[model samples]
Target chain A: MRSDAVLNEAVRGPSGPRKHRMLPSWVATTALLLPTYAWLTLAVLLPLLTMFVFSFMSATPMGKAPITFTLKHYRAFIDQPYLLNIGWTSLVIGFWTTLLCAIFGFLAAVALARATVGRMRETLLILILLPFWTNGLVRVFSWTMVLRENGFLDNVLHMVSADTGSISFLYTRYAIVLGLVHGYLPYMILTCYIALVTIDDAIIEAAASLGARWWTILFRILIPMAAPGLISGAVLTFVPVIGSFMEPRILGGKVGVTMGTVIEDQFTQAFNWPLGAALSFTLLAVVLAIFATFSGVLRRGAAA
Target chain B: MNNITRRNTLQLMSAGLIAGAGYSMFPRKAAAAGTITVLNWQGYGTDEAWSIKAFQESTGIEVVHDYYSSEAEMLTKLRTNPGAYDLVVLNAARCAQAMAEDLIAPIDYSKVPNISSVAENLRANENFNKDGKGYAVPWVWGLTALAMREGLPKADSYAVLGDPAYKNRVALQDDAVGVIAAAALLTGQDMNNPKDLDLVKETLKGFKPNVKLLWSTEDQWNKSFAAKEFDVAMYWSGGSVRSKRVSKLPVDFVVPKEGGIGWVDGLGIPASAPNAEGAHAFANWMIDPKFYVEWATKAGAPASSNVAAMEALPADDLSRQIHKPEYIATMSIMSALPDDRREAFNNLWQEVKAFYAE
Candidate 1:
């Protein structure tokens, strides 16, 4: 309460502080903040705070947490190398997902915007978004069925092998990439779509009338124009995908470990909240850094 | 939040805790009783509606249950302005923490009339009840057993998973405990002895090279396997049994002659539970023989702790899902161990994985 008054005074000026005069306003206007603050506090702040507190506290003898405060958990998190490896894996997953999403999204957006068709254009665009209607879990589950050993892909391989000689597929890092691409590929497409949809068809037609080759226009104007959306979509997809536990948990099988799994295990099974929190925050920091970097890149790309 | 900000908040909590009676501020139960909210990790308790539905129908309590994928999430909700949940179900080790932190209240058994009906061994189980008096009640317990395609069956054990012939055809449960334990058992390291990092590593190295994939859930994994995904894998003993029955596959499970890890989950009342009476009613209702029997009949994991509950189960399922009482007594249950030991296993397990994943 006192801090609130002080903040108000700092903004409004001390002269009319008591009167609450027409001085300055809040950093975020109240109407704007009501929803935003609630969202952040509930979804982000409180969870992060709890993770931080649990990090300081000792894990119960069962390797979880006790209310008792201790630094032993932080020490444990720092000391372990296996958990550290998970951080590296998380980065790899995030980077690759973003890169892939950017490529596929860019190409799809190009086709959607420039390709001339009446009903077909709208229909093709709608088809691209059809996967979004399904829940994320459903999409991931579908992939598991398709890729599991002796699953559709594996059976296909086996069928081919029966005719030829050998076969295998499923639950490899390759399986994980297939899942990641499936999961975030839509975000990329959506982002790139926004950029492409905004462009006037005349600009491309005008460039084409000047006798520019199709590939030349895509490389020069269309790509530069849509680069912002492509990067923005990559940012959206990559930032969270970096910390994703599910795609890997379900598809990576035993072969995958990302920081998300490590942080999760620390809190749930390991009972070392501090270490989990520390690890979580470590992952959080990495995500934020990338998020910031991407935001910077997109801003500059928009300008460029 | 930034590190400094997080540190300040934790410092405040720690200072506040020390200044008061060292327990967390358990939210007082509500007076007039609105909805009794229950939060649980996903896939816990009886399958979908099993844990809460019975309580709602029988007691006329309007219960709202939310599922979380992690305990940190549940703890986050409780720690920051708790008053949302009336009761929570957590493992025994967590019950001790919650109780000490004052995040949970000791279960007043007198209020829960049906508690004594819980099986005798579980009543005094180390994780659920710190004292003989109840604070948390055991929900479901089973050993970490391996399941395999039964068509090529001989007497089965963990060693079958390591057989080079089965390499890339076998799957293991993709969890730290199951992975480490399976590896340790094959290596002849004590499952209970979480220390012996080197042996665990060596054992997991042997097992990992043979393992095809690790699984996190029964739903997709089983469907894939039923459709001939991975030939065999480590599975929840109960689920594996159910899967075999439903798939009508030649799938069989071994308690593992070398040994297996046993796990148990308990339901506890959070200190901040909004409806103590309702929560008690719910907990009591959850453990009933009738309830346990339904879960066992449909779910395959029999609640053997309750003799009456066991009686309610089909005679054949009792023979199959849970072994005989004498065998149950000898069965080793998975316990929460200290970090150094657990991490030691995690480190070794990761090494083995890196080798195999390579």
Candidate 2:
């Protein structure tokens, strides 16, 4: 409270160091944060609680079936060994998608922050974000037109050389990862750009004046400064990528069954809501664990 | 004059944001009265077919169309939100389940005299009728058949889907019932209750090498087919006809020699419908021979039950494609599955999908 008053004095000018004339600090803080906390409670916390309760049920309480509490839903992975494999597939997709997005997005952010300026940089940022405006399903479907056999990519390859064989990569894991990266690249870029743009150019110039090479300045200054953006972007990408079934279903085809798709089947096709809820909680645990592990770096980055 | 300070830019942005939010916050008008909402499948709505516009113009009741992708989705929506929808188009297998759950009310035949134009065989079908009581009125019926590019070898058998020659060139339906039934039919087992679970598993496993994709929604399959992603697929009978006709593609749909899975999608009123009168009127108007003729001709769905509609169809290539005898004879209709067996099939499908052929 003392620090906040000092900060307020700094902002309001020292000439009129006005006496604290507001409500108690705690009351003011609660009043300011009430709406946000209420929104989170209603939207996120309530649904999560409902899902946890449903996870313990024997059957969906719909139709003629009587609902009973059971642990069998949690034992789904053990009951069906294939779920383990699907979980592993989801992990693999999450890993590759995050890695690729970080690399591509960080480089794009660097170029936008350092190499471009003004209108050009603004236009490029808009272009990067344009995909997010369109429906994700439609964008994923469009990838099929480019990657399928005799598709646009194949035709382009053939045009370069008549003897080129089919280069169709659709219905493959590689295509799934590619589509995911395309879908999430803008987010990573945006976060990284925000971090990078705030970086002081004088710091790099000072390093160069001290006989530091381009690589040294980049490794020592740019990357460390941008770490927060990269980490946050990766967390955002990895969490959703693990929960995505549509991209894998459309692009990966027969090979696309992952933990996300399995959970979806339980609710939509199998009508096994309890099992789906259990699987969802398991995924949530994994996501929370990831965030927990990175909490330190995230806190430091956020402060930066 | 052009020195725009950070504070000035922030003020401008805030002003723009306020205008945008204020515009959206304005109160919108309520829905007009006498409006009846119908929830149906994607392509079945009047916006796609345009024939249903005639009914709306003739009757004063306004028709609002919504769409549900699957039977489970339809059931969930109807169960959770009573009185939300006046009419719904549900599959035969689901119609029986819906009636038992009291999600839908039994049809009052007196209110819909167009039932007379529908064939007796269709009205008495097990899906919509229980103890001589009709629930949903059957509208469109089709077989899940094999659709291959015209020049490809005639895929008259399900075995062709697993043939090494067509490896990485075939797509199957992604649903548990459709894939399991197809596997059962191929193995010469009863589709509804196959005694040989191991053989069914083996049949689906054997198909892994040939299967390139498993498409779930009609939109998924149609887009993939239009892009020529696969040479052959387990095609939705009505969807295949529509796509082939629209694209002028030389794709032929034939009932596989192993027989085909069949389904009948029709209209029914929700038990808690707010506008039951409007719902019945809309249902009867849609099934009338006069409107069904246009639906059959324009929608590219077979009007098997509407006798007059069938006769009115042009005796042309399009009509022949729409109406096929084998769609009925070899058709294995889907029935409600016992819970344990349903779970078994779902698990088996997951295993089959995860299977990798060496």
Candidate 3:
């Protein structure tokens, strides 16, 4: 047939060039695309697959990697009451920290967006955002030095105590939360500012003429409009804060061990990488669930 | 000097030629032999005094050193794909566990005659050479003791943490061994008995009321203690010496009359190593009394295997160190207990963590 003649001609061509002609453009394009996909596959996907595989594995006697796969690690987590308790503890910390960051961030952003002439606002804004300019570890270290009883705050406290009798403020849960909020507050503020700066002043004026009180207008219109920003800010703040390793580590000391430290120990010094991976996966799953729920609600709210 | 001249010439050539030809043939006398890598703790090296610089100078066999922070971390490395490393430095307690699993090889002391100079007290330590044969050289030893801030109520023992005067001002090592040892010491129970897990749990809970902080990292220890965040800190001898070096305040290192953690970390070659000759040469050089004392002075970690070396240390405050021979005699060498005991430790550790986390 004519097809056989064409195949014969293709085969008859020099073998090196003929091989290239056999493949389609899409196939070549796919081959060209493969290195990038391969890089991601080797670097990210393979490890994630290993994590998924080992969540079903067990810790060996020598405290090395899992030699056999079983659901024991996951089952171990489910059966343990303390694990459930830790999960709840993480949720509580995440929810409260997010709430505080969102509230403070929204107010601060609005104040920054609306307040004073150009340079003053710029200077004040820089001062507000300066802490974020440092690495998170350094910032947390700065807080540790600041909040300790022997630190700068304590020096002030000692000056006060010299007048009074004494005071103690370190190693409380208050310090840990305070550290996390300060660390993550800037992101929340940025998110809120991006949302707030675009709103027309006329919206407020319209609400005012419609006989709505300022609080009512804020509650009914402003807050609802800013809801997306608030939600995004919550996600931004809570995700890192909840999974924090260093902040709670340095600041929390004895008074801390959120899900973050648990996961960290499982990997670094514990030699239980698989277990650590599982713990991280657990944290990630929770984060993803929150994101999904937030997005779902946002889509519905936007449609409304 | 001739080899050095050739090496300089090789350096000037193209990088590829240096890698391929000139350098390998030039070191015909010594560099013909390959390298020996030592995996040890950070403080084990001798840059200031207790460093490997002298050994390298004496032997001419290139020595490379790397460090790990914890015994568990070191064990993990040794167990899973021990890279080109020929030797590891580890505490005998951990070594017992590692050797039982055959992760490391027994050291032939005849190959390291300098090991014969290790103190008799150290030689007799059952933890290091339980079967009367040596697979390791006693490189260094130290204790975990309590260091307290000045002008605080006299903390003669760890039990003082429970004293109402020190409430909300106590720090404990966040490690399982330190935690358990402190518990055993405070409870007036037999320290070596390996009692029921619940008993250990109850004893540790008492210390919980006063201990506001638990430190796991060396940096955390240095910063927290220096800041005087706690009135009393349970600390290792190594960190205490370093803190004492730069501290403006008068810090007191105390080995409680009750007892403390005494440990001996030894240098041993892994069985899988091909360069046993290099390992032996390095081990012999390390156990020299002069070398041992040298590192202790510079690194601020006093050595346990060398009494003569300790006596030889010229640091004026060496006398102030809590490493009294009599006190060290009272200290029991820590050993890795059975698998069940480790599990018991973890279980109790979780309980302690839960109490504090809440």
Candidate 4:
């Protein structure tokens, strides 16, 4: 009976005999959070949901045509039979670009962390990251000026030998990979540098005191410790390079068909939005699978 | 005190986010009194010629301009944001598609009497009108012709594009339908619809080895061509002519013996136009002989749609090159493709692009 009196007092306020009660703390917290979460729901989540719905549609939602749901958009790869080839081409580009960036970036990070000190290291870091500040489309277009036939590269060669044939390497797979590596190398370097900088110098000194050579110290201690950073950088680079269309279009030219370009065609040229949405979901699935496969390393890196 | 500060900060952040989202959801527009908004390509305004400014001064309608790079981009904008634009410049082939989608409204010819002043060949062309009603006015036209570097043998046939001698020295337009249509022209088949997919595929494959680069943007075209990246390309008429005149290169534009594709850009009013009357006024003003003359002279393309306007311009090299009525007659005009045919051609083009080098 006393507990019932207390419940009545809590519901109707401590001093008043009225029946209205104050809202619970949890409800107040939710109310405070609603506007922010609602913004997110309206901006990002709603568009994703709309795209997911459109993927199952028969055509773009234009004109007075009847709307139907079908899986034919998803099955486009099977029907055309050549989309598989494009997918494989994209995979190949991603593999090469990632491998090159990993090798180049890890070395640059090592040099910055160990070799340089004070203002020298800071300047070098700025130099490495300078490209990231410029616009990517402009950077990609400029490479054409440097790599096209009778361009900067060929002119340099001409100075060395008067009768040399033009060593034009633009519009090839090599040029595409070169442009992509230039664009993404800074990302890998920044990631690996964060991991490398935290390594205690004492650990390296102790290994050297124990009769370990530079190669031994690097292979055994440095690499294994920076594995998480390397893995995360690779994941970031690989994901974007696989879905890249502009770099391949500018540099790879006629041989530049990839899943990204195909999806772009659906939206821009063919006016096939349903097929584009389905292909995007397929790409998203691939991205998710890659992250799931590497979540452990990412978690470790974050913790570090 | 700490708890109160934290709660205040959270509330402020939430308020800021809500405000931002609301602002983005309904973007603020300038006051709309006497404003005539036009959606068009980049070069058609007073920036390219003085006539547009002259028109605005005469009409007292404030001109607001928005630009798009491609027809598809224009279509998407029209679909998403209705009633925001008064006029849109679209390809002649897209008139039917726009009508069927109810994206544009029928034009009143009585208001735009300048329509009668255009050359009879271009006025009320089937592509711009339907069942005696007009929806679009022909503005500019050009051809996709063969372009080769100076001192090369004259390329009179479409077969020259596929020749192995120019291997690794050829560029094609990075367009799906245009590429396949050109290939169809090479085989002497129906340029609009090729019944035999396999035959077209085989024909395109033969040309693939020689085509080392495929360019899409005008910048890419200019930079690469200036650098001597390729010996020959499927070049746009106006750009190729400018390249020859400016750089004095042996850049030659030729109408291949097989045929070439002709494209016409036209101005139309959207169905949901807020200022349809102003749009008609602008359309009428655009096709006026004096304005056409100024546009053709400044923009460096012929005003074939307005015969009186073409005659007004001096008989110069650029005018003579683009104003050839006989050449225009030989050109195969583009038309809206049926859905089934469009799909088939798109698929075939994808196959050609994805072809792996052996």
The weakest ten consecutive residues by lDDT in model 1 chain B span B1-10
The segments of candidate 1 whose C-alpha lies over 4 angstroms from its true place after superposition are A1-78, A117-122, A154-168, A200-206, A287-299, B1-141, B153-157, B184-190, B263-318, B321-326, B335-356
Q: Native-vs-model 1 lDDT? A: 0.65
Report the lDDT tens digits of candidate 4 across residue range B31-112: 3248778887655432232444455556666777887765667888888999999999887778767877889988887878
Give lDDT per model, in order.
Answer: 0.65, 0.78, 0.69, 0.76
Give candidate 3 regions above 4 Å deviation: A1-47, A60-66, A76-79, A116-127, A154-162, A165-168, A285-298, A302-304, B1-43, B46-88, B97-117, B151-157, B185-193, B269-285, B336-344
Distance from true location, Cα of B164 in model 4, Å? 2.3
Task: Please provide TM-scores, in order, for all candidate models, with all chains considered together.
Answer: 0.66, 0.77, 0.77, 0.77
lDDT of 3 by residue, A1-304 (tens): 9999989988887666546647788998999999999999999999899778766665533454336766655553665557666677777778888888988999998787766558987898889988688888887788877887667775787776666533445566676788888888988888877777667889988989989997897788777777767777887888888888777777788877777877776665344655677777877887888778777786755443
Q: Please give the lDDT score for candidate 3.
A: 0.69
What is candidate 1's fraction of native contacts? Answer: 0.39
Judging by DockQ against the true structure, name the best candidate: 4
Better of 1 and 2 by TM-score: 2
Number of the predicted model whose lDDT against the real structure is largest: 2
Give chain A TM for each model in order.
0.78, 0.92, 0.76, 0.83
Q: lDDT per residue, candidate 1, A242-271, as tens digits?
A: 778777777776676677666666565554
Tell how far residue A44 is off in model 3, in angstroms: 5.8
**CAPRI accuracy category, model 4:** acceptable
